[model samples]
Target: MHIDLIRTSSKSLPHQISETLSQRISSGLLQQGVRLPSVRSLATALRVSQVTVSKAYDVLEKRGLIYCRQGKGCFVADPEHTRRQEDGRWQDVYDDYLPRAQLWRNFDYSEVKYPFHIAAIHSELLPLKNIGDSFASLVTQQPELMATYGNFQGDLELRGIMRDHLKTRGIALASSDVMITSGTQQGIDLVARTFVGPGDTVYLEAPSYTGAIDVFAGRGAEMIFVPTDSEGMRVDILTRMCDQRPPKLIYTIPTFQNPSGVTMSIAKRQRLLELARSYRCLIVEDDPFSDLYFHAPPPPTIKSMDSEGHVVYMKSFSKVIAPGCRIACVAAGGNILSRLIAAKSASDLGSPLLTQRAVLPFIAGKYETYAAQLRVTLRGRMEKAAKLLKLYAPPGVKYILPEGGLNLWLELPASPDIGKLHELAEQESISFLPGDVCYSAETPSRHIRLCYSQMNETDMEEGLRLFLRLLGRFLQMGS
Candidate 1:
């Protein structure tokens, strides 16, 4: 209705009108299924003849830019032409989903020499044989489990086993308090779906897990970033923010947080629980890497301190057992666990019975022995990686040697020309996770996460040799 028409242009009124509307449709200004103004109304608004507007509408209809509904008005059409047409037409109609971890979603790293971007344990260290044997044993003993639908909440035996495991983490839960999910990613998504909504406030660490950031963003939650330090999320800053606008949820990874590899201290954990109690907001504790500690346990999990059922605790076995099994569980005290069960039923009838059963033996008893060996393997890799950094890494690169966790967080020079560094690394088949994706909002990225657990001694050394050289050059260029 608000299109501009030049009176003196040589182009006919109808030709200009159609071109303008077509361009508008081609761009996203007028999205699909939007109703256009009545031809008479548009004609009157432009002070033009109705015939001109009619001609424009006719052209739009023939080209399939829009469809006319009986007794209604012309509406923009779905982007079907994108499939038939080239010239970047697909971009115009694509869903434009942005809440994904860009590294995994966009990159093609199949041929990379050094894949430090990945955060999973090396396949060599995973308990493939144990899990496979467990699978065979389960199928032989319980064929009905493989054939029939599982309880959407999860396997009963698995839940009981997980309940015992939680006792070690200082989280005591009833049988009904625990619900199984595919992994922490799905668990966070379920919690977000159940609690967060548009305009709902959620507090998160500044450099939180990329998956958690994507999940909350996809739910349209207003995320408030609480800064973190060597001890983990700064409860002091969070306290001020909470005083102003109390959030509906506070999500934290108290033990060996991803990307930063920092752990929250016990005092702050207690204070965080206190704040949650004061404000009556739900707290979601994501604890995937807690069992991967090198020297000593980080601290008691925030969930363990919550006696009031204010916390929802998530723990994943993927890091130790196998990511393919996709095993994780959630423990919540209140009726919220029931609501999560409902959401789980809607997600997938249940997680694959095969996978749940496959991980049962490991989680039940075999985990302790396998975990000890896995930790030693990872600690060796971490030590080798640390030595390589000490020998080859340039002066400006700063990092904290974490006690445990897969990633090594590096803080490059403030004027880090990360784009150039990334390009150079890519040329040599070295890949890492840029720190920007770990954040909820745009921040100056002078950080990168390198996973030492993914590569062995020889390969890790060679990859770091090339990477440090390129990084040195990039940092020097910035200076």
Candidate 2:
């Protein structure tokens, strides 16, 4: 119950006192349910004002380390309860549905101040005020939207807006051809659930979006990994695979393809569509990063080349727009679009009407301007990151300066231990997505994906510098 007070430091008396109690609770020195000394007594003993001790206890209670029972004073919270509250036992139920090892797990680095692993736009770059105003307008204009379940196909107005948006990208689609999704991930899941099932064959780029891989694998689909090169997925190899074992679905992120950041050539896009039609395979073209190009626009999407209704196109706004909005749309013709709408109804009735309406104004009005500005900002970040890499990257490190995307894929020296490097990088407060996770198969890779968009210029430089130093040390030791 005794707290040793430091009387001579610049830190306020309350923070130091709170830190001491936090340490005790965390270390188990103060047992759960152990009653703490009364504020009056502790204040008297420490020779500090009662208010300072009261503030300290307030900090502890706020942090869930302690709780006060009015007249009974404060007691240390049950560590078990605190642990449960912080991280629940959801895995107990989840394990029944999927093997714990097979489930897609992403490292949470929210506590890490400098994070390069996240493939998300920094919040500072988001058009928050504009979106906030849109939300406010929705509430003022159509208050009933809050109480109504939207159309199973999504908000009609939002879909119409997306229809026009897709048209600008050379993807001609009507409102009937479009289905709103929570994001590209959900769009992928909806497609997988509608078309793919156990024993169904699915083809994905060797290094593809992990979320899509999880969705297809979760549905018990047998995945065939198609190798990709600087020109994007090797359509020649895919053609060979199609001849051998025609897949039910071919999932691709052809525009600035994920992790590798390579765009498919126009010829490949046309040939891919032709192959899909010939093989009677459905192509799920996930196009999230096409609008993020720095130089000339990427080739026409495979979906754009798909005139035979062979392609299901998904475009996500969560990356370029606000992530919280969770707005994305899928474009398909015929029964595919119809089945996706049915799946959408089964998933959650529909995405939130409120979110759909909130983003409508932005799409209808300032979207083009916002996207232009974002491209400029992101291009600058990409350039800065490229310079840092050139200056600080270790010898034998190789990478393709992405034509336009948020990520840079780095290939370490031959046979380097990525796991050890990851451990050391984490110890230094840096994080990245290892290349193995990007693959559909379980295999070793000496590559890592570094997302530069999430970090500001300063943190990005510092994190890369630290990573380079650690990488060099690790390589030297191996040599």
Per-model TM against the reference: 0.81, 0.79
Q: For model 2, what is the error of residue 437's alpha carbon versus the real structure, in angstroms, after optimal superposition?
A: 0.8
User: Candidate 1: misplaced stretches above 4 Å?
Assistant: 1-91, 94-103
lDDT for 159 (candidate 2): 94
The C-alpha RMSD in Å for every predicted model, in order, reads 10.7, 16.3
Deviation in Å, model 1, residue 62 alpha carbon = 39
lDDT of 2 by residue, 1-479 (tens): 44444454334779767865664454345657666788988888778999999999998998677998878778888745333332543432221222112123344666665688878888888888888987898889989989999899989989999999888878888899998899988999899999997657789997888788767756756678899888988999999987777779999999888888988898888888888888888999999898888888888888777788999999998778898888899999999899899999999999999999888888889888988888898899988888888888889999999888799999988887786787788788888887866764434678898998887778887887788778888999998
Model 2: number of backbone collisions:
0
Give the worst 10-residue stretch by lDDT in candidate 2. Answer: 93-102
**Clash numbers, per candidate:** 0, 0
